[model samples]
Target: METMMLGVYKIPEITINSGIDWLGICGIVLTALIVVLGTWTTIKNFKNTTLSQEAVAEATSNRQFVHIKAENVAKNRQEWINGLRSEISNFISACFDVRSVYLNQSRPTGLVPELFEDFVTVENLERELKSKLIAAQGEARRCLSLIELYINPEEQASIDLVKTAQEIFHRAGDTSFNLTWECDDLVKIAQGILKCEWERVKQMV
Candidate 1:
């Protein structure tokens, strides 16, 4: 009976040892699972951080492109306006020369036989004035075309310039009428051109 009791006690001790080994195995598995989950979470966070930084960098590059385009357009616009101003200045100078030459040859100069030569000089001056007026009209029309191309806002200024140029050409074409008759007409034409140029310069900005 004592031998039977000792064998039964040995079986219980074996059972306890088996249970401790199983517990240790379960603990090691749980620790491995925790390590795997932590590594996956860290990888996901790093990927998300990289993508966000890339998106910000792309947006910044796009903004720079837009700014550069705006600046280039503005620069080209100013250059166009300056070119028109230079053309107008040349036209005004030419008109002034025509007017001065016309004014100087107003009255006849010389006596007897020389009177015929003086008359011829006057006639030649008149012809030169006519040619100048025609040239001025052509240039003024070109100016008007440029203004339209540049999308100028000052319509009244353009109209005034065109009107003065037309008037000068018409009077010159008619031999009976003359630029000397309207001394201020050339100046008026110059003023009108200047006004139109000013409007164009303002629009460039």
Candidate 2:
């Protein structure tokens, strides 16, 4: 060991020959601190990167789910529109058929009442007309039921449509019923509902 002076302070000078190299020891310690700091920084950065990736994955999954749900809703609405339109048309046709049958039955056929053959023929004709009227009425009822099922009770437009459809069904048997006017009104209401649903589908895309 040798003494070195710096102003009023005296310090021991360590050398390799003295079995303790102070400068080399300090260098080793500094290098270890630097390595430890670098490792800690790397670990922190890795955790941040992993977190960012997970966030992106979660966001992507949410978007995909929303998109799929919207597509299904739009598809179902379109199917509903088609089914409702078909049922409404069928109901109107059946009502008209029932009216036609009633009208035909009311009109007198030029058959001699005294002739047994003519009496038998008239009875057969009445039976056939009654059977056809029943079938037409049955079909109209079935279509009306389906149309009501297709409507959403919560919506004002759907409520109005259902009311109109019910009225049409109730009055279909009347010979004096203006079926054309009622059918036109039903069609107008249906068109409005369909158009509104279509616009909602467009917005989802």
Candidate 3:
């Protein structure tokens, strides 16, 4: 057995062996603690990395959804505008035709003598004018319907414009007591209103 001296004392053989054993046990315990701490740190880092990846993925998906929704809204709005433009143009053309037919029918010297054989008769002239007015009214109603379809009813500005157009259309129908005004004048006013609305929508888009 080997004897180890501490300070001025020579340690006994059995005491030395016991001390060595104690030191070995302490070393084992310290090694085990170090391993446990290393394992905990690794697990914590992995958990943080996984959470970060999941958050990034969720944010990307939300961004994509918003982009797609905006694209669809734009497409729908453009289609509505194109359709409304065509309908408004048709309405204006119909109003112009009604004005011309009414003036020609009422003229003493007929505008188209070959087309209107019964232009001199008051009854025939009035009947033709009534038919033309009814057709013009139909076109105007189509314009109103288009406005209702394309515009939000809650928007007060658009609603007021539509009301104005409706009043003008109804006024065009009254030809009582041999009184008639130029239909094109009302039609032109409606056209101006529609163009203004369209310009406002374009700015939003």
Worst 10-residue lDDT window for candidate 3 reads 173-182
TM-score of 1: 0.54
lDDT of 2 at 155: 97
> Residues 92-204, candidate 2, lDDT per residue (tens digit)?
99988988998899899999878999999999999999999999999999999998899899999999999998888888878788988998999999999989988987887
For model 2 the local lDDT of residue 81 reads 79
lDDT of 3 by residue, 63-95 (tens): 888777766676676666677667656655655
Model 1, 21-70: lDDT tens per residue?
Answer: 77888999999999999999999999999999999999999988877776
Q: How much is the lDDT of residue 61 in candidate 3? A: 92
Q: Using lDDT as the measure, which candidate wins?
A: 2
- Superposed model 1: Cα runs more than 4 Å off: 1-22, 104-145, 151-205
Candidate 2 residue 157 C-alpha distance from true site, Å = 2.5
TM-scores of all candidate predictions against the true structure:
0.54, 0.83, 0.58
Name the 10 consecutive residues with the lowest summed lDDT in model 1.
5-14
